[model samples]
Target: MRGAILPADSDQAVLAGRLDLGEGPTPVLIRGGMVEDVSAAAPTVSDLLERDDPAAVRGRPLFAAAELADRGPLLAPVDLQAIKACGVTFAVSAIERVIEEAARGDMDAAAAVRGRLEARVGAGIRSVVPGTPEAASLKAALVEDGMWSQYLEVAIGPDAEVFTKTAVLASVGWGAEIGVRSDSGWNNPEPEIVLVTNSKGRIAGAALGNDVNLRDFEGRSALLLGKAKDNNASCAIGPFIRLFDDGFTMDDVRAAELDLVIEGPEGYRLDGHSSMVQISRDPEELVRQARSEHHYPDGFALFLGTLFAPVQDRDEPGRGFTHKVGDVVTISTPKLGTLVNRVTTSDRAPAWTFGIGALMRNLAERGLLDIGGGAGDGHD
Candidate 1:
């Protein structure tokens, strides 16, 4: 006997199965100041997160868009122990990084490093094996057993003490704004499609992330990445989480489109779009690398990297443009909606002002190379 097929009117059923709605819950939103499950279920997003099987609540009814408030403030969708990010996983981003690294004070040294970076990233694009010449060369650039590198800067390390800005910036229905430091040498919102993993590194769902960074700090010296990435109020993610399920296929993900739109304080707009095909690595690969030596008992967030960049004109090089305070950046995609944030400068005191001058003077008095430039000695 042949099996019966779901009728054409079963598109809702298809969505339910695809998003794991029929069992646990549809994507939940804190709409109209009330917790509402986008799925037809009564379990709130918080309730679903606490369940052993969050998707079990999907059998509940779907929420009507009309009944909920048209718009309101949105949360980060889920609470994760750590927010991690991958780098050099896109062709355009790889090239942009090489170019920026090449411009780091010395043109000749930067040129040599740029060639090596290009060759490494190119080989990685072709294959992921460890023993290959490209793999070995790339591995050598990074220390700590290739877990960290010049390109792969960890925005949020496994340390829980560093979590910041878990809530997303809300702007009605269009998008959101992110804060950028005005004094930062280079700042840009990298549009990334992120993966949400469980405590054990299992894929749970996907969300959109804006991996905001200070490119100049990163370029100036590879050792200063912490200063470049771990600035206060520098990271954000939101819109909603799309739970992984049998129906949510890779084809569905690759077919979706993503755009990174920016608006400066003067209202000048720049359009940037990313191609999923340009994604160099998959979520599994990113997760494996992120969990290399550390244990994420509370799970973690992983940014899959960016594939789009601003267009370059004659006056500007490939990525000479940088985001300044008051600029707004939005990551828009059909699956994840629009995640937005505005750039703003931090008001904290300078990092070098905490008795550092006296310490430097003390070291100089001891004849320890006068590293602090006292009396214009400039000796090390």
Candidate 2:
């Protein structure tokens, strides 16, 4: 399972992630298939990424990557970093959001609304670049046709919708249970590429993430976004963060393609795909918008919105897909590896008790809080 979750090119990809060795989250590096405890280099991932070259930093040898399944459970690969996400960045997702809105969160109504909405404006939304005159014109046309939507506004408007996803230390890692709201009748996993950045907003690395969402909550009212998104163990990020190096860079991210598979307990199977190339807004552009007015002192992980939105009927024909308990969701891309998690209700999932305060206390007790050195200071 450890090897399955690692990047296909694990030997070449420079990776950084966290592991719980009984006490607390420990920063580690996976280079040349070996996992090295980098606590001395940096106590937290936020601090590790602050370095000019995180891949070059070295530390005590822990175990081989293959031995990860026997080690402590892997963490979300981030600590002290803000979790943020962009929405409506892909045409298909944008259209889906509009359908969610138009249907007013009713699962039965969504199918009908989806067909009408797609027939009306899908091509126009797909062709125009966001924040362009063409997009504005499309917006005007939609409005005239009584089809203007807030989702469409963000989809084509100059401003991207960047919002907080979850609290620090709240996201689960690979093989953990990802949660959906207990009462949510309509929800699905959003498989996306999460950009890891420093305080300066420089994208340092990328990881696979499942932005677990409740369509009904958000569809009923955009005001319910907080309730729809932030739930216990709702966000899933990791196995590891693939740090950008000579062999891997932002260009690779731009061309990256993601594949999603959800295997239900009742033998239900759903497969989806998302290509970064089809995104309406560029990854760098989304980052710029995220950093426009706010500041993430501890850095942040930005979820690049997905192109895949499940519209397949799970049970009844008109009712669309929704997660059932015990569903095993796998989001994978060759370069980033796989993020596999089982489905559970938010209330039933393990509670998130380890927070920023807990992390500080743990680091202090470990005598790792006093280390002070920049990028090149600690290395082999």
Candidate 3:
């Protein structure tokens, strides 16, 4: 139930519980490239948006998705090798807050705090150009609903959500679909990257950060600078939420296969269906740990303190600002019914870690991290 707005740097994405679209789900993917302002009728997902957010819609088209089919940008899934060589800007700070705080309970309160933090982070960044209408509106919206946050899912196949895990890693601002789990290891023919695989079935995360950065950057901060969202069109996410449930639960990773096809000027770029990387921690754990680390505040004063921390970096702290662009996103999962989030980033030396302990412990003391544990576990 707990999840952040892809660009955790945008608005606050409170992790709710597991929301099963009843018996079936009508899931469609809209990539960053396809993120166009297309106004499509709502799909059958019933409720995609939040009940409170009247601007919410059951289903709508994405502007990024629109750009992908029509835009031109080098978007690809990266491994730990690539991430290391490139560096990951996806700082698990703000989203981590949402996770930890909500885990304590107070979903509504968590939202308010995270929302303010995201806005603060967005506004703090120096606009490349400075002052233009788009830039100005973007700056204002950064505190409101700027360009850093936006998405829309469409229902593609009838059995769209069949056995998929939609891992929308805001770090990458995209998602992947993990189909099934594998018993053996995958000899990766692909480039260097972090392959999220399942061990037994507990779902642990295996990160192979690149040992060196090939760019002209120094440390994490320099690397983070590379993560800036430039001509980067859009990022896309999966057909459905990859879950380790029944029928689809073959335990063996080979039983699952989620695919994504990218046709650029170079012909067709095929990914997935090939278990090059193994995601140790499945999506569930990703969300679980993400939230587990967030230490909320206690009373009103403490909450206020956490909110106005800097009103600047106080919200997301370290690298969270980069999340506004999210890192490189992907669609498609592996065999184990989970989504593998392929993201990009800068070096790892920067102090991007958000002080969840400092915040959450305070919040937990007051009774956050509850939320009934995300509305989690779908019915039988």
Name the regions of candidate 2 deviating beyond 4 angstroms. Answer: 1-3, 371-380
Model 3 / residue 327 / CA error / Å: 18
Candidate 1's residue-wise lDDT over 1-380, tens digit each?
01111212222222111122333213453222223444333222322343454555534244543322233333345432366777766656755565556667232344455556566555553343323455555555544444344443321222111222222211111233344455675667778776766555566666777777676766777666666665545666665556555655555555557787777788768788877765655556667787767766545667777787543321234334677667777777765556666666644312322132553353245443323322113211
What's the C-alpha lDDT at position 49 in model 3?
22
lDDT by residue (1-380, candidate 3, tens digit) is 11222221111211111111222112232322222121122111111121232123223343432232222221122111011111111122223222223323222244454566455543333222222344445445543543232100001111111111111211121232111112111101111222222111232222111111111111112222222211021122221222222322324332223332222222323342323223222333333332233321110000000000111221243311111112222323332112223322223212223233543353355443343432112321
How well does candidate 2 match the true structure, expressed as C-alpha RMSD?
3.1
lDDT of each: 0.51, 0.91, 0.23
Q: List the candidate 3 regions with Cα displacement exceeding 4 Å.
A: 1-233, 242-244, 249-262, 266-277, 282-284, 295-380
TM-scores of all candidate predictions against the true structure:
0.63, 0.96, 0.24
Tens-place lDDT digits, model 2, residues 1-380: 33387888989998999998777788999988798999987899999999888988988998899888666457999888899999989999999999999999999999889889999998999999999999999999999999999999999999999889999889999889999999999999999999999887889999999999999999999999999999999999998999998888999999999999999999999999999999998999899889887767778899999999999999999898999999999999999999989999999999889888888888899898965543334321
